[model samples]
Target: MKLYYSRGACSLAAHIALYEAGLAFRAEPVDLKAKTLAGGADFRQVNPLGYVPVLELDGGERLTEVGVVLQYIADQKPETSLAPPAGTMPRYRLMQWLAFISSELHKTFSPLFAPHTPEDYKPVIRERLAQRLAYMNQQLAASSFLMGEQFTVADAYLFVVLNWAGVMNLDLTPYAHLQSFQKRVGARPGVQRALQAEGLLGS
Candidate 1:
């Protein structure tokens, strides 16, 4: 497998997923702003959406989207239990959290990264993020991860998106549980490896 990623992008989640699964994979850096891959290949051809977090499977099948890619990697190594077994309640619940992050938390922050985002929109976005984060904190208060004591794919996705707090200058001081979540997820060997590989960490 090969993962195309840009430093600190959501692709970091996918990169970490592969590592956590003990999967052998190659990292191909993408210049997201330039829309070019490591080999000078037009990234548009790899993923017309021109986004980071594209994974090329061993058979040459390409997977785009972080949520899907993380799930795929987890499914590849079920023993890792990054996601619960398919067709089970735990699996569906994991999917539920993934969908929530993708639609609510992830897309909600999109405007904050936009060059033309209106000044007035910032507070509205921050409010929504805070509300969603509060709900998450309450839900996670009883468990170590979003799904419970076990670390799962949902944690990875949430951790990656939540890391954007710095990008948006959203202080996390008030979210204690969420802050703990960050520390827990960051301490994982695989996540640390991913961060180091992305140049976001040092050995």
Candidate 2:
């Protein structure tokens, strides 16, 4: 499998999942802004949407979307314990957290990264993110990870998105539980490997 990604983008979440699952895959860096691959190939041809985190399987099947990609990787090695067992209550709960993070927390943070983003709208988006994060903190306060003591794919996705809090200047210090949660996730070996690969660890 080849995972095309832009460093530190949402793609990192899927990349981390691959690492945690102990899956064999190749990484292809994408120039998201230029819409080119590392080989200078037109990226739009690989993914018409020109988005990063495009996973091309050996047989030519492709997968996008960070949340979905993480699940796919987890399923590749279910015994690795990256995801809860399928068709179980924990799996459904994990899906709920994934959707919450992807749709509510992750998408809400997207506009802040846009060069064309309007300054007037940042505060509105920031407040909404704060509310969502508060909910996450509450959920995490009672569990080691999104699904509990085990570190699953959901934690990987949440860690990637929450890392952006620094760029947005979001004051997570107010949410003690959440800040601690980020620290725990960041310290994981797979998380460290993913960030190091993306050249984001030292800075």
- Candidate 1: which pairs clash? none
The C-alpha TM-scores of every prediction are 0.96, 0.97
Q: Tell me the lDDT of model 2 at 174.
A: 77
Candidate 2: 10-residue stretch with minimal lDDT: 140-149
Query: Tens-digit lDDT track for model 1 on 109-190?
Result: 8889888999998899999999998898888788889988999888988998999998788988888899999999999999
List all candidate RMSDs to the true structure.
Answer: 1.4, 1.0
lDDT (CA) per prediction: 0.90, 0.89
Which TM-score value belongs to model 2? 0.97
